[model samples]
Target: MAKTLLIGANSTIAQALQENSDREFICLARSEGNLNLDGDLSELDDVTDINGLVYFPGTINLKPFTMLKEDDFLNDFKVNVLGAAKVVKKVINQLKESEGASVVFISSVAANIGLPFHASIGASKSALEGMARSLAAEYTNAKVCFNVVAPSLTDTSLSTNLLKTDRLVEASKERNPMKEIGDPQKVAKTIDFLLDAHKNWMTGQVIHVDGGMNNLK
Candidate 1:
């Protein structure tokens, strides 16, 4: 059986993926599980195996550049970039052992497009995209594929304040050609497709899961 490690198991996207995927899941979350990239995944010492990995730590504090502090950028990069790197570094051996493994990082469309007050988050996510591409190139010989998913506005508790008001919702919809907020399930399904063994042919790609928000209309 293929074992998949999920870094942010508590996330809505992670939950959706777990429910939709047939692969064996090794869930990891901050404080809730033994796997903490910030610390160590000692439990894996006993398992010695896994097929794929998905890192889904993210933040959605959209604020003006001036108001954003240095810590904001640091925190974003820590969770969005360094956090993923730590987990990947720890389990890289297992990934290599899988002989054909896939790693997915959750990014944001803000990485590609310029959005007001999205400086910190965008910069961090952009780094994640770049990092994934580099890993894909470096680990191709190891039979490990690395990629990123950049989603626009999705309905999650993290962004509930922004998606609450009718005005905010309509404005968000009008910005996208699809005229709708992205569904968490749809995004999860896309992640599922990218992580599938069949997708071994594809790597180093930054897929946009936005509802035509980054481009079109």
Candidate 2:
């Protein structure tokens, strides 16, 4: 049985991954969970041989680039980029222990496609994508693969603000070429695949789980 670790366990996407996964998952988060990476990760000391790591911690800071202050970009980078880097660094040794370990970072379609008021998030996620690709290159021989999953607007707690009203939801649907918002389960399934041992050959890739928003639009 491969051991998997999930950060931001309380997140809807993480919960979806847990519900759909058969492998035992050690969940960690701030305050309400097993561990908080914001402070210390000593909780991971006892855990070993981590075969997979999925980082679900992220933020959505939507504001026009002109209105965004320096702190806005910094805050988004802290959550989306720095946090994932820290978690991955902490578990890297354990990942190296597995025959074929995998790391999946949750990103956004905004990283690849331009959208108004998405500057902070897009910049941070783009950094994350670059970091993941570099790490994948460095760890390829060690069998520790890194990849990203970029999803469009999904009906999750994190996205409640975007889908608060029927009009907002309908507008989002119309914008997507698929005419639908992505489901958490659909994105979770893709993450599950990236973490599978059989997916050793598939690394350093960005999988767009959007509703045809990244390309079709």
Candidate 3:
């Protein structure tokens, strides 16, 4: 069986996936794999086939729309959208050749629901969700599934700035309908479910692992 490929593998959710899943993964992150997200895709050329690919690279650029500049939007897209595109392109052949292949992209709840200071990330994540749907449609015949997992604020290192103080943590939780934040392990389980091609029939779908933040009032 072809192993799953995990980009930006050092992320908290990515780490959770690594620990909780029984399947093996090929982890390639900026820090560990010497990955140059903007550079070339030659590094993964050695892999013969890829059954699963999950993009964990993302940005947390929380700033008011007025404060966000063009560069900020471009940078967020570079990480959240373009980088995933590049990685998928590089492994396109392998993913197509492999049976029951799947691709998963990480998104944010802010992409669906409006949130203050989330313009940049929201835009990029929304683009990612759109791109994932498009890719799913493109590869439907190829048997290569594509899906997205969007989550709300989670207690991760990437979100330390937002959840630094107890007040901030409580405030963030209060905004969610569940009155709680996200859990990396739980989100990882959702990703793992998508990775299972035999059990999963869903595609072009954005599974909101958020605390009912996308729909609830």
Candidate 4:
């Protein structure tokens, strides 16, 4: 019986995971779920015996660097980076208890490649990738595997606006080798694979789930 815990369980990716996952699962969300935001994660006495942990809470804020304010950076950092950290810290013991536990973090291609109007979100995700690597190194002895999946322009509620216009969609499609925007379900499947036993041989790597948006011209 594998016990997996998911944060941001309401998001499309998380919801997809819930629909596809065959293992026993626990979900933490801001509302209407097993756990709420007010639920302090630093104390995880209740959330014990977990084998896999997935942090799904993320943002897809796209705005020019000049338009960004101090608060913009702070808010993005809080949600994308700090929020995940809080939950990870709380579940560290349980994760280590699992010993050969797998931890998955959601990152974006914006973290590495330069994108117009993606300064804030990109910076935060870059930090997230770094954090994953650091933790993977720190908990090596505990056999806790930490890895990140960085997708580009995934078709989710987070990027609904950009995907709505035909012109925008065409332009985005033309830019990728796949010639289409990435499906959230596809990305979720990749994440699911990463969290499985097959991933035991891998860690501290950022696997790209983009539709060639990052690599291809």
Per residue, candidate 3 scores C-alpha lDDT tens digits across 119-144 of 89998999999999999999989889
Task: Choose the strongest candidate by lDDT.
Answer: 3
C-alpha lDDT of residue 81 in model 2:
91
| Local accuracy of candidate 4 as per-residue lDDT tens digits, 1-217 | 6588888888888888778868678877765555543456533558888988888888877787788999899889988899888888888888888768888999998999888899999999999999999998998788788889898887888889988999999988887788878888888887888786324587888989987766777
Better of 1 and 3 by TM-score: 3
- Please provide, for model 1 over 136-159, each residue's C-alpha lDDT reduced to its tens digit, 9 standing for 90 to 100: 999999999998888899888677
Model 2 regions lying over 4 Å from their true place: 31-33, 197-200
- Tens digits of per-residue lDDT, candidate 2, 40-116, equal 67777777867999999899889988999999999899889998888887889889988789999999999998999
- Full candidate order by lDDT, most accurate first: 3, 2, 1, 4
| TM-scores for every predicted model | 0.94, 0.96, 0.97, 0.93
Better model by TM-score: candidate 1 vs candidate 4: 1
- How do these models rank on TM-score, best leading? 3, 2, 1, 4
lDDT of 2: 0.88
Colliding pairs, model 1: none
Q: What is the lDDT of residue 18 in candidate 2?
A: 91
As for model 3, its CA RMSD to the true structure in angstroms is: 1.0
